[model samples]
Structure formats: C-alpha cells, structure tokens
Target: MKGKLKKTVVLVGMMGAGKTAVGNALARLLEVPFLDSDDEIERAANMTVAEIFARDGEPFFRARESEVLSRLLAGSPCILSTGGGAFLAPDNRVVIEEKGVAVWLKADLDLLWQRVRHKTTRPLLRTADPKATLAGLFDARQPVYALAGITVESKPDYSIEDMARKVMAALSGRHDVMEME
Candidate 1:
C-alpha cells in the first residue's frame, strides 16, 4: 500500500551511494514517482552529466542542477535522487530544507570507492588518482551532508532493497515527510 507522502524525499550523498538505485526502490515501495535531478538536467540539456561537466564546467552544471532541483521540489511529493554535489551548495540546501526532506545515504569511504571505482560515468572521479580524490571529497562533504534531515547508513552488504527499506524506516519517524498506513 502507498503511504501518505507529505514531503518529497531528496536522497543526497556521494557518488555511487546508490541514490538512484535506492530512490527507485523507495519510490516503488511508497508508490510514488522517482525523479533524479541529474537525469532531469541531462534530458533538458540534451547531454550526459559527464559531457556537461566537461563542456560547460562544474559551475555551469551546478547552476543547472540547482534550477532542476528547485523546479522538481516545487512539484508534488516524490522520491528525488540528487547528484553527489547537489546538497553542497548553501542555496540548494536552503531550497531543499524548505521544500523536501534531505536524506543522506551515509557510507564509509571504502564502500563508496568500491562502488564507484569501476564506474567511468562519474565525471568527478575521472582524475588521475580517483581514489585519493574520492577520499578528499568524502572528507570534505561529510560535514555538509550531516546537515540532512535524516541519515541512513549504507553498508557494503546491503542490497538496493535493503537500503530502500532502511531509508523508509528512517523516514517513518518523520510524520511531516512520511506516514505509514
């Protein structure tokens, strides 16, 4: 059964944190729509995220990301998955705080690396030393991501369904965001 979703659930975390995968599962479990900010941006721009970052630079991409996020958050409640850096900006955080419930899919650096190491789609990880870059990013972003409304720890052993269920459980306590039937 679909429960009442009073606010949009925004999934935020590092690359390969399973935001898209887990958000899809969460949306299915909630019987709500699943939206990804990066996908939305890509569709509108008619370019992949990597291409956008490479061609237009991160600043331009971030502007588009914020625009998409604002538009989506203005719509009906759903499960929204954001890019790795979406929640880092203060402006984006303010809008998300006002319009949706930010949920950080917290995972250890090792787990994150294990998931992203094989993925070339991540533009940020295209550096010479991606592992070190990822570690630095993880260290810097942890404090910012901690500002989310909820935190769901993601372990290496957890499947998409498990993470989705964990996220659902975490949101269950927030009557403003979710209400179990």
Candidate 2:
C-alpha cells in the first residue's frame, strides 16, 4: 500500500552509503516517486557529475547542486537522494530542512570502503589514496550528517530492502512526515 508523505524524504550521507539504491527502494515501498539530485544536475548540464566537477570545478558544481536541490524540494513529496557533499553546504541544509526531511544512512568506514573501493565514478574518491580520503571524508561529514532529522544505521547484513524498511520505520514516528495507512 502507498503511504502518505507530507514532506519529501532527502537521503543524506557519505558516498556509497546506498542513498540512491535505498532511496529507490524506499520510494517503491512508499509508492511515491524517487529523485536523485546528482542525476538531475547531470540531466540539466548534459554531462555527468564527474565531468561537471572536472570541467567547471567543485564550486561551480556545488552552486548548481544547490539550485537543483531547491527546485526539487519545491515539488511534491518524494524520496530524494543527494550526493555526498550536497548536505555539507549550509545553504543547502537550510533549504532542505525547510522543505524536506533529511535521513542520514549511517555506515562505518570499512563498509563504505568495501562498497566504493572498486568504483571509479566517484570523483572525490579518484584520489591517489581513496581509502584515506574516504576515511577523512567520513570523519568530517559525520557531524553534519548527524544534523539530519532521522538516522538509519546500516550494516553489511542489511539488504537494500532492509535499509529501505528501516528508513520507513524511522519516518513512521514523524507524523508530520509520513503516515502509512
């Protein structure tokens, strides 16, 4: 059954934290639309996020990210997955908090590394020592991510579905955000 969502659910966390995958499943479970901020940015720019970062630099990309986030958050409620750095910007955080509910998909460094180590698509992880960079990023972003409205712990044993359900469960407690009938 479809659950009613009064506000958009914005999935925030580190890269490879399953924001896209879990957000897709959460949208399915809720019977609502699923949107990815990075995908939207790519579509609008006619290029991938990595390309945007490489060509225009992170500052330009972040400016566009904030614009896309505001536009998306203004729409009807849905499950919106954001890039890892999207929530780090204070302006983005303010808009997101005003328009949607942020959910941090918390996972350990080892788990995040296991998921992203082999992936080349992550521009931030293109570093010479990505594991170290990822560790630094994870440590730095934890406090900002902690500011999210909800927290869903993720472990290796949790399938995408399990994570989605856990997110749903967290949302259930906030009557202003979700109400499953």
Candidate 3:
C-alpha cells in the first residue's frame, strides 16, 4: 500500500474475475493510473466491446486489443487490465512479459458463472449455453494464466477490496515489480 510500482501490473483473467475492479482499487492503493485495454479499444472505436465483436468480429477486435495493450504498456507503470483472451495471444503475452508484470486473478468456473450470469455486457457469453462456454473458456485458459508472474486467487467470499489487497500483497514482496517506500 505504501510503494512505488516498478512496472505495470497487468491484470489477466476471465471476464468476471475482477480484473477491472481490482485493478482500479490496486491503482488507488498504489497511487497510479488504472487502464483497461478493452475500455481503450472501445474508446478508439467509438463502440462498446460487444458492439465491436458483433460488427467487426473477434479477430479484428483482438488486433485492436493488442494495439491498445502496446500503447498502454509503453507508458509509465500503472495497473492495466486486459481482456480475457488477450493473454492467449503470444504477441500480447510477449509484450506484457517484456514491459509489465502479469498477475492472473484466478477464479473457479462457478465463481465466474455467478458473477457473469446476470450480465449482458459480455459478448462471448451470449451463446446457446453461456455457462458451458464459460466453463470451456475457463478450462482452456487456466494453463496459460498459470504462466503469469504472480497469481492471486479469487474466491466468492472475497470482495473487490479484498482481491485488490491480495494483489498488493503479492506485489509487495516482489521489489522488482512493486517496491515499498
């Protein structure tokens, strides 16, 4: 809580894993900017993420996501939240690896489903069976997310503030990533 971040703390995980929410709290705790790649993409395209996906398709959206990530990473260290699929791309991973510390907010499928089930903002979840799709994505992404520099587990009982503090605690010991003043 009393430190200068040494590099961007990139939050990577599923849509409902609290990347954006935790990133904002963590950035406030660290006294730095909080940036979300999807927000940036939406801003640039003048459309919401779902709109972009619906109109241009995921490949086009992903290309823009990579562009946004690169631009965000090039700036000073901050809390950066990425889309769920951003880390799946090797190029984005390489850029984040070289320029930032990736922290995966790991949550179980059930936890994710509970958080996202009522939400309509998620384009990927709009399917015949969104729960099944989420489960599939969760299974496919876990191994890749495990490659992150640090991992903070997400539990149903943990509030957004609690998750943020957990991320801060993980970063606290890594002086190369975040150094206490």
* RMSD of each predicted structure: 1.0, 0.9, 0.8
lDDT, residue 150, model 3: 96
Give the TM-score of each candidate: 0.98, 0.98, 0.98
Off by over 4 Å in 2: none
lDDT of 3 at 9: 93
TM-score of 1: 0.98
Worst 10 residues of 2 by lDDT: 1-10
121: Cα error in model 3, Å = 0.9
Candidate 2 lDDT, 139-171, residue by residue in tens: 999999999999999999999999999999999
Clashing pairs for predicted structure model 2, backbone only: none
Please give the lDDT score at residue 171 for candidate 2: 94
Angstrom error at residue 139, model 2: 0.9
What's the residue-level lDDT of 95 in candidate 2?
A: 98
Per-residue lDDT tens digits for candidate 1, residues 64-120, read: 999999999999999999999999999999999999999999999999989999998
lDDT (0 to 1) per candidate: 0.95, 0.96, 0.94
